[model samples]
Target: MEVVVVTLAYTLTGRDTEIVSQLRTVSDTLQTAPGLTHLRSYRGRQKGGAYALFLCTWDSENSWRKAQEQYSPHKLLQEAHKRQELLVIDPLQWVMHYVWGYTRPLAAPTLAAIHLMSAPPEQEVLLQNGWRRTLQHHVQEPALAYAFLAHSTTPTTDEAHEGPVTVLFCFFSWSSQMERDLFYSEKQIRTMHAFSEQGSSVQILALEPL
Candidate 1:
């Protein structure tokens, strides 16, 4: 089983660049830590807040704890936090630990979906009515850790690539290949069949954190 460490931080109004730089440094340090398999950081589009995701492949929680104790990155982040308080308005930090208790390491790299729909104006309403419900139900299954929605005001790297007004980021944690296989066969595939019937255009990607 693998574990996920998710951290969320909000920066002061004008400190976005500085905070992101510090977070990049922390991520670089995490790259060298034992038990750490993947690390990625995301900046909120509207408010310039940030989210850091870490995927750790550990023999056990004890193994993760040992690695954390020896990793200077943890302490460095603590120091950064102290400095951040002076610059951030009301910074928020949250850490969530999830374990895939079934059998296999969760999926490698991981999966991401970027939807480019034709009906830009009606997309959000359609998604809120149906897609959200389907995903919420899908995530409640034991194999999934958690899933939620985030609205970002940030622009895509290329305006040409932008079609939809919002993005949906979903996270899934699986215990074993069998669990994921069953989920696709029994749930996701069927849901896809239904979603396809509704003529929703979506783009999906599989991503790896580094």
Candidate 2:
């Protein structure tokens, strides 16, 4: 697929409703970009108050780069983030992926999760394949709406440079958190934990729409 999705997830000192209000000006300007297909926002809760995510779908990497040069929402948000209005718990773990697989979710996703893992360049293949098998288990549940794994390609071009792949991200959406819980048993939970142990900087962050 030619589509590329860039995700920016961060913990907000306040709710995204306020941020949404602030984004009106930026969103209006962004909508006119030719390569930008969609720009969406999401919010979720855990121990902290709320976390926000912005998902941007672009026609291709080149298109996304051009938009960045002209008007980068990421930079605008980053400035707000530095001011503590939309702070990121971990700046390094943001999600960005190219659409290697595609399947529309039957139902609107009320909740979502992004699995992040990274290791040395030599170990990227092991982590990538392992996560694919892990994602298969997640999609088996009836509540699972849709899931996709990142294409195992280096940044810039798919032609591949001297460096090997070193990180991978996979996303999955659920109809609801309750349905997600009902589908997992103690055995299943154990299996999930087992997969998490295979790589470093592994994180399974829970999320919901804004």
**Model 1 score (lDDT):** 0.45
How does model 1 score by TM-score? 0.41
lDDT of 1 by residue, 1-210 (tens): 344443334345556567667767777777777877655544443434333333333444555567866553445566677865423433322222331122223534233222222223355356544655565556555443333333222222324335644333334434445655565576654675456336544533222232
Candidate topping TM-score: 2
Runs in model 2 with CA error above 4 Å?
A: 1-5, 14-17, 23-30, 79-84, 88-105, 134-142, 151-165, 182-193
Model 1 C-alpha RMSD to native:
12.6
Assess each prediction's global lDDT (C-alpha) against the native.
0.45, 0.57
lDDT of 2 at 12: 59
Q: List model 2 lDDT by residue over 1-210, tens digit each.
A: 244444454555556566655545445666777788877555566775555555566777678777775546666556555654665554332325553343545676777776655555555566666656655555564546656666334532222334433556666676777766754543654565565566445656777655
Off by over 4 Å in 1: 47-59, 70-75, 83-210
**Total backbone collisions for each predicted model:** 3, 2
Clash pairs, candidate 2, are 42-210, 43-210
CA displacement after TM-score superposition, residue 3 of candidate 1 (Å): 1.4
